[model samples]
Target chain A: MDMQSVITAAIEAVAAEQGKTLRPLTDDLVLLESGLDSLCFAILVTRLEDEVGFDPFTLSDDVYFPVTLGDFIRFYDDAARSQAAPTLAA
Target chain B: MQHAAKPLRRWLLEAERGRGRALLAPGTRLTLDALADTTGLGALRGALADRNVLVSTGSQLAAAEALVELDGLARRIVLAPPDLKPTDIPAVMAGAGIDAVLCDGDHPGFGPDVLIAVPGPRVPLPDAAAAEVRDTEWVLLTSGTTGLPKMVAHSRAGLIGAIDPSALAPVWGTFYDIRRYGGLQILLRALIGGGSMVLSQAGEPMADHMARLAAAGVTHLSGTPSHWRRALMTPETASIDPRVVRLSGEIADQAVLDSLRRAFPGVAVGHAYASTEAGVGFEVTDGREGFPAALLDADGAVAMKVEDGSLRIRSTRTASRYVGGTARALADRDGFVDTDDLVERRGDRMHFVGRRSGVINVGGLKVHPEEVEAVINRHAGVRMSLVKAKSNPITGAIVVADVVIERTFPDTDAARAQAGLKAEILDLCRATLPAHKVPVLLRFADALAVTPAGKLARHNA
Candidate 1:
């Protein structure tokens, strides 16, 4: 139901695709330095886009390179909030 | 020397001798004059004089320049793919017997000092080097679908002799990286034919790349069926309209051919049959799946035959030798080299029947099943593993693995243990194998199906 749980479920789905297990998710967990390889990270982003209905990587004009799990979750959160911000302004 | 009839180097020098567009990419463009002056290519000519050099630049411009200049400068030149993992570079360098590596940017952490960055800006080309393009050996790596990539040695003359002269346009675009065999053919075709090219950078988005090629006004475009399929799926496909569209590397099945024909109506669509060992073979422009049956014995530039279902080809352009690995002869007494690609007679033509060797083609790239299986088998909990191909709509085929675990767990928690082991095995595979070679699907089986011959069955569920 929460942003963190949504991100974690997507990550787990990708890890499940490769039969990989992830270290427990934490704020400072370096995604690249974690068990996820580049391919798994890519799949995670793609799957998360489908589940959450917004892909931060594509929506942001400014390139955002998120190294940690918190940065990744916040990236989507910021994109989602930004989408709602326009509505809030209206 | 006749201007129209010249080798790749001579044509490049004459066409771009003053200042001509030699290479083009999205953010980078190098002229013949710029290539000669700034790229340290002139200095590289002298530095590699009488020496064997490996042109392994990650930059497309640098690679094109190195390949063009090194033809006459180096006694032996090996073109190593820039995408090769850092850990795989040393063995490749040592195997190719390279004395120096011509690259730009950071050293890929191999043969540290052997890296000679492509030279920088100079006023004029270095005083004409005394080196003549002697029996200069051109070594290229075969896409190791069966085992480790092997260095296939070829001569400049042999490579150039195969280019079919064309009166087509000047601008060319190709999906191949010049480092590989298929890409080199396109590179040489443009170089020897006095044409410019739009180089596709690896890892660039296909839609954007297609748009770039369109913006470059590319008249002739060449790519694998997988590439064309991927490109068509992209929204930018409508932007590029090439006069000539060619496919190679993987089988151009009727479905792909028809789709390409439908997508690019009125454009010429054709596929050529060629391999690392066989050089360039017969090409069919009939918009069909395979070459005409008559090419088997027709008097042509090359010769072909089918022996025990495998196609064999012999021609001047065929590879000169296998540089590394077992010193086994590549060809038999009569010059015919077995392509190891099985072919079957289908009506009036011969259709490719997959590789006789157990190599699965994932798109245009080859993924050796045994190689992935070996990595999977290394996992502590994996008792045995069987890697095989699973067809996909995008990539022609993807890798899938079936593994039998070494240990058993209680029924309630068996699923959890199985999932854990599966992930571990995949992790091990990712560390050892290339990304494409990693199995897309991992399944834990009670037992792997075996053939009557007591070998693990590879195909069919």
Candidate 2:
């Protein structure tokens, strides 16, 4: 799956677990505005870690402060691309 | 007859002179003189006087010493424990009127303020002069887990007055241990009692630190229910050999209290109920179910009336005013400050029903989150739980539970395991709690949202 799809799946899994209906979580949608409270946000980070290899808890400082969903996705996409580039070079 | 100077400053000074040892960590020790030279408190006093100084160092020892030094110089110091995001900084600054910000970590580009990038045990520069001010000597921010955090400002005398010498004597001997406010108070008491103080780093590994505390032969240990929960879960916590273990910050439910008593059979288990705005009021150490209520007068309310039901304390330890706000005048009209906590009086003792704010009006009945959270936390699968009101069209407001489950069942299917856990938790709650008190919805996670100080953020949940 593409990075956006992966992110969407992660968000959906958290929403499902929280008994929240999934809305179109755009890159611009603020995590707080996405009907995800603090607990759900923490769950979402955990789910994302399961899907991706790295733990997303470290991104909390960034996510809580200035970063938005779009910012998070871009960061994730960049990291994914960098990881892939090494294999491609090999 | 000339009385001697306060023992707190004297002990610090003696520790500085290398007559006594400074307990940095468990095995790591420093002379008081060395600590004094390293923290640069003398220069800090000269540079940043009455100005609202923010001590943002990551080290607990440095931060604790800075707080003491600032208190000594009569500087209104706001101790911002590490892990505070830059986003939350502005609101704290505005509320407390912080004049300068200091950080031990690499500067995160926090605007134009003089960002002193000094490490611990380094000499403080005298460039920043202390401000001549004295409205609020210390402003502690409430862990804003719900909404915007509130600043609790205490005057120098008021803060010191809040300490009860006898209450702390049972747990800590010549050594002082405290959790949150109690920790600060213990530090103050060490100074007053002519004792040595040990400091714990905020975010270090729990097991490692507790082992250190065990090796240091700590006499006193204090923390909130949540801190104790994490400590109990720690493998090394079994090794701690403190003479006293005290709990505060939140309500001490029976299960957790019982567990603590069982764990530390020889040690005294005590609990105190107080707040940032009200300061310390009621203390219970005899393993009581609840704290004794404040004494009431002939008028059928609290006898020490300052306002409404809020505690009207006349002790010399009361904060002069809310920092950055107007001076606090006792609302003697009722002769008591309404504590906002609903209580049931049993002769001289008072059992807490719930805080007026913490009570949830579910349909016609009222429920307390603490009661529900206690039930949820009792479940073995649940690591921690928080209960709050979510807007509901049918009930107006419904109770919701957010829980963190233990990692033992990590490999189990998330959906199936969560369903089973929820069912089990709901069943337990139904059996013990009132129908309305049971949470309508349950949210599970690997971890709960915690404040920098390791407190569950109820407001955010």
Candidate 3:
């Protein structure tokens, strides 16, 4: 699955597990308003990390928290692409 | 050279106080004189004499019945709770110098060459006479989740210090497993202080256990605040009309205390501080969350001092020494056991914030999960909450929480009252706690998991 599909599926799984229904996974949808709490997001991140090879959240020196569904998917994809082809970390 | 302390039977506060009162459980009922003649271990009595014996009974009631007979005969009595990991048996037995294994049915297989069968309380009074009793060392295992459990050795007097030598016998009940320190205290209280006790069975549902306690007419009931909170959610809670209620093992937050007061009106609800290593520290009785500040200054039987935010206790109730796993002093130079429980002074009273080693380092700022959970639990809608850390690349970790809502509140969807409840809980946290300690995210769980020891299970992800 692509990063977007994996992230969306994880969100659905976590939300269902927490007995929550998602509002929408649109790019502009605010993360806090996505009917998922921080704990659910943490769980989603964990699931995504296990499905993928790494977590972008732990790779960067600068503190980063994806604010939306698009941002979360993009961060994972970027991390995956960067790992595929060696590039300067900066 | 010293004479053995008064034997356990001699410590019975009132031999004839509560007539017909017996140690009660699901299938067995043993009166105080249940072992006057037959002990089931008659054949092995000579083999176990003067040896360190491990009481690895199948049930707490069985263990209780065995302790009554084994105390004076055995040089050391090591209590092994039923939930002890099978792998920890060797370390525990070797550390306690266990020479024999006593059980209701079969032994744990690896402990010792000598395995003694305990007939429990229901055995027919046999021809064998009661075993000789004496003052013996009582070794209790600390319910630590990680690594091998610590073995804290205690003298008979030290273990029973909190128990008054009186004739007031009230049927006692507790949520603690009998082998742990807290449950042992309740057992000793019932035995030495002239009362019968109803023991909780392993894997019994909370509601069924409460119903059993109610059926047994338990007057003095005690448990951790987590145990009480989970119990309150069950419909059986209001049925058990306890005269005296006690909370230990975890921080008794104000919300739980208030809820208990409402549930059992006119009952004496109290919170006490105690640990396997520290013994029975003190009890806070004024219907408050934390103890009074004057407790440290007063000339009381249990001397306490707070230095560098940690509570230190010096009392006869404190365990004498650590027996196994690690070799470290149980008490300091001044005979004070460092509780390692941090506290903060709030005006005239001080509240236990959390354990010193349990801090969640959030971006270099320290946050105690118990302290944060206490604030969140104060919210009316919250039944119980567990605050723990979630790993984050930026700050290394972020505070998160799992909240169990009061049963009355409906949460069909996260967008319904749960959102409002979350907002209210977050507001409560923000109003009282700092920004960092405020749980960044809270998940609504039907129930929060509690450890086998009955404390809220706190695991950082």
Candidate 4:
């Protein structure tokens, strides 16, 4: 699946968990401003781990914190790329 | 039948005359004299001479000293935990009508007139002040809610009514901090029985506290089911050997009781049912999850009945009222207080069915989240589980769960292993519970959030 669709599905999952319906999102949307506080962020990350794979934050070798929803998608994209690179080369 | 009641001070003084030790600290044993000589006793008694005091302290030793000294001086005492946010203190102080604080800081906005600095020279209460402590209320704050702390008032007699004057004086240890209701009961039970207690510090690490209890040779230990679960997860718990193990403040499932038996061989495990609003209700000594159904009509001191799945209790030991707040009768005109704790009759016993308001309704069928959580928690890989309700169009609501995995695996294959565990959990639930009760969605939380009172935070959404 493409990164954009993957990220949108994860966000939708979190919103459903909170009993909320989210408006369509854009790349420039700040994650902290998405009404997801520290508590909701924790649940969101948990859901992301299940739908996608491991938490991108824990999988990456270097420290990378995402600020906007676009950055969050890019972070996951980079981690997925790195994971695939090892298999592609073999 | 017209006997006069003795003051709280007199009863404590009589207990102090016994040869048993009063407190067991890390390296020191405290008799009643040593307890009286704890720092700032004189200053506390002096400040509490004529007015009510808000005793908010982080130190358990200081709290014990303040409680005894306040009672000795016939001073009205309200216990407000110091860990409360600065914003919540003023309203609590106002509600309790507190005139002074025994802590060192003016953080509660209680100026010089209110703050009583400890570590000052000792000044004992004058003999006249100890004449009689009557018509005084001991106010305790509830910990579960987010709004203003609910202030509960209990008469001195009512507080100690259920404490049997047994000659056995076993050293005790408790997981509850003394500020909360569950902790206060253990403290009073030990003191009134002329026994020593290893007080658990508020911010101390559980492993460290368990080590201290081991060092103090804690023979009697009581805690909530959550506390026991956490303790059993660590190796430090193996150092302590308790003869009398009591569980309260939450439901004691057979899993926890069986584990306790395995951990401490030959230990007598008992679970008691009590709350801050409702005094000591009843105890089940027969290693079971619920009380015997026969207790509803048993000629016990406390009368109990299950009405509409909620336990109603009527006893002389029930608390007086909420001071300065509307007094909601815990019982009906017949003196039965609706405890709000839901229970279901299972054959010969009544099993706890969680809180009434917390139940998850799935397609008009009632599902107790605690019951589902209990079943999930029994799984070996599950550390803790929170069963919640999710809105669905077809079925009014659907059951879901968030669990913390206790076992760790390689980082490369963690998700796959977690998926397997989730499958196992789902299979177990399907086999044990009804179709409607099984969780449709099971997610993994790094750690489940617990309430300040050490209970699982349910239905956060």
Candidate 5:
């Protein structure tokens, strides 16, 4: 499955487990405003890592906190690509 | 001779005829007489006399042997736990003024003036070596609010003030390592209380220990709540039956108490409030979570009262003083040891909420992990749980929980069943606890980590 679909499914799965209804998962959807709660994001990342083979938070040295659904998905996608093919440091 | 002046070897009691009690270790067993053996202890006593000694043995079994022999010989005996970090050993040695090191074997770790004695079953003690000597101060290490271990000193009379040894001649077993206060209580009980003790192996498996306890016919067993939870998980728990079960060192939540009662039908399952510093406060055997409110008002040897949610006990049972380091006074001017365990009054009973220092700051509110864990553990699916804080930019920190499922569900609907259990746990938390105390992140674990002290490890995720 594509990274976006996988990430979306994981978020839905975690929300379903928590009995929470998410505001529509869209590119510009702000996570803080959504029904998802703080620290529940850990469950999302854990589920995502099991399905997809990477946890973006630990793989990259750069500190980044994604604010939107798109940013979250993009971060995981970039982490996966970088993990699969290491690029030379600029 | 006074009991205080007598060594633990003198405390050893032998049952009439063939009923002699023994220290039953996994690979070996030593009867009461063997424990009283002065074969090598005669010269060893002279060498260790009037010295500040550190017992850093490799095993709990060795510790028992060392403690029995060294109790009266040394001016002060400091117990070094088997898992003492290498980095912290020197500080411990310096703090307690540990001049001599006693070990089971040769040691490069202790210091230059190392004394060695291989403790095990030996020849019967000679009658001449049984004479009592000067009183020795028993020093125990407590990891107080300050992370570093502090040396707490106690007298023989103080340690035994609360233990009313049984007349039934019961066999004792414990999940606690004997170096710690909880485990040391059991060893003392077996020695002076006319019972045999089954000591847990240093790195033995839980299943193996339970099997050993069963083989030794353990009539009474004691451990922290964490140990009992893990024991309940092990299959051998069913075979290892005891007449009486006890819990100390950690909060005994309703879930574990009810579970123990269910596990051992008609057995006397009790929980006591005891610590390295507070000694033994009281025992509640009515199968309740906490002690009765009347206990506080009642006149007893141990005077207890809750001040600002923390339980304070003033009694002869409490450790006398902080032996070394710039440690704060063990007791206040009123001679009360601040237990630092927070308890909440619910009707007539005061349930232990959590440690006063272990509170997790959830936003501006405080959440005790033990309280959250109690709520989560009440769920039938959850065998055990650890509630910890997860750092969040939004709320400073948020509560997170890792739950260990009691049993495996069928593969056909396992995922669904687990999800349903998680939802139920969250619902239970919501119904019982405040919103801020509710765990935001929940994940199932195969097993939760327990520390060497046999309490739940609560490192933030």
Candidate 6:
């Protein structure tokens, strides 16, 4: 599956686990407002790790600054693409 | 063999030279000199002289040395607990009359007048004559679980004197060589004693902390009961040297102490009774269940007083005031700070009856959640437990326990195990606790919510 499709699936899984439905995780929907507390956000990161093969949660930087779902997805996509570029080049 | 200067800075400098040991926390290991440099005590002297400085930092060493540096500069320092929320910051600032704030990067925003920033390398200010301040000038905030937080003010000399390092000297040789008061106290005492401070950035992983302790050859280690409990449950902790384990924070129960003794065999297990308001009160090295009432005054309170079974303490070591409120007298008419903990004395030892707010009135008989939770926690399958008083029309308030089971149990069959475990816990409570104190309601939760400070959120339980 494409990165966007994987991101959508992960978001849906998180929403399901939280017993709620998301109105499509657009770039404008704030993660905090979407009911992703620190713990849930951690679980989401773990799920994304499984699907995307890379965990983006690093303590040295602020990964939670992106407010909306689209913003988070874009950030993840860029990170995944960059992470994969070296391997593809090899 | 001997150091002449008695200043806190001098003590830390001495420790750095003598120990040559590093205090390790995750990716950081700070030497005494590095810590001293970061505080910039020399420059802070001018900015903080005769001013109240509020320190907000997660690094125990930084917080501890900052206290010492502020003391050296004659600045009144208020050490805030790690779990202090941003919402309560304004009130604490106003209550303590905090003139400035010193924080690390993790700390949030502060007011413009608030001198909020990280401590750079070295003491920047020039040395000047010590600033004058009143005796009863330091303030600490109450945990505020039962009601609104209050400021407990104390005199600098008096507060420092309350530490009673001699009481800790016995077990110090056995545990990690680092001073114990959680991390903050460890750093403060290490700096004061001129001993090396160790840091462990072991997130929630018990194995990581054990590895750090083993790698550092840490002979003195202190932590909250919860931290110790987590360590005990972890398999890796058994293989690590137990001779250096020193437990503090909450009251040490017999089961927990016995468990530690069994695990560490030769290690000395101990306990301490202290609060933000009372500073350090009493120490128990024999692994006693409760603190001795004699350690307290006539009120049967430890470190303070017993107000209708609620512990209260008055000390020169108390905080100046709440951060946002006017300076109110922490002492009663007779001059003692109340700690608000309930207690029952037996001979020389006193047992904590649990917090007054945690007491549940079941059919007119009082029940402490801790008493019930202790029974629940002792269960083989349970990892942690929180017991709270839930309203019941017939009983007024009944004891309800929420338990978090260890992951070793199968997830699919967790409900069945939880039911069996709940029965086992109920049976244990019935055997040990009084009929009224026995928990009537049992809940098996995936996890218990904890505060930033690693304390269970008992208020919401």
Top candidate, metric TM-score:
5
User: TM-score, each model?
Assistant: 0.64, 0.66, 0.84, 0.79, 0.86, 0.69
Off by over 4 Å in 5: A1-90, B2-5, B13-18, B113-127, B143-147
- How many steric overlaps are in each model, in order? 3, 37, 2, 4, 2, 64
Error of 5 at B299 (Å): 1.7
- Give the C-alpha miss distance for residue A10 in model 3, angstroms: 18
Task: Itemize residue pairs with steric clashes in candidate 4.
Answer: B42-B123, B330-B337, B331-B336, B331-B337
- Give the per-residue lDDT digits (tens) of candidate 2, residues B164-198: 44343222321122324556676666554434555
Predicted candidate 5 versus true structure: per-residue lDDT over B1-461, tens digit per residue = 56445567766633343466788887888776667654445556667777888888887877888787777677888998767776788888888888787777666566665554444335556564543465888998874423678888999889877666556679999988889899998888887776899998767899999999998989999999999999999889999779999999999999999999999999999999899999988999999887898888889898999898899999889999998678899999999999999999999988899987789986578999999999999998889999987765446677888999899889999999989998899999989987778887688988887888888876764
Q: Model 6 over residues B174-263: C-alpha lDDT tens digits?
A: 122121234445554555554444464424366776766666655666776766767777787755664456666565667677778887
In model 3, which runs have C-alpha deviations exceeding 4 angstroms?
A1-55, A59-90, B1-4, B11-14, B115-133, B408-414
**lDDT of candidate 4 over B1-461, digit per residue (tens):** 11115544455556546465766554555565444434355534565665677887767766776676676454578887645777877777777777877764334457555655454544544453453455556888876556677778887777778877575878889988777788887777776676778987756778998998988788989888888877887789999999899998888887788788888888899999998888889888888888999998988789898887799888878777777655455457887778889988899999997987788877678898889988998897886788998754335567789987776778999889988998899889978997678776798887776665667766534
TM-score, model 1 to reference: 0.64
Scored by CA lDDT, what does every candidate get?
A: 0.72, 0.60, 0.81, 0.74, 0.82, 0.60
- In CAPRI terms, where does candidate 6 land? incorrect
- Worst lDDT 10-window in candidate 1 chain B: B449-458
| Position B101, candidate 5: lDDT | 78
The TM-score of predicted model 2 comes to 0.66
Query: What is the lDDT, from 0 to 100, of the residue A30 in candidate 1?
Result: 92
Decide which is better by DockQ, 4 or 6: 4
Which lDDT value does model 3 have at B19? 72
Candidate 1, B326: how far from true, in Å? Answer: 1.4
lDDT, candidate 3, equals: 0.81
Model 1's C-alpha root-mean-square deviation from the true structure amounts to: 17.6
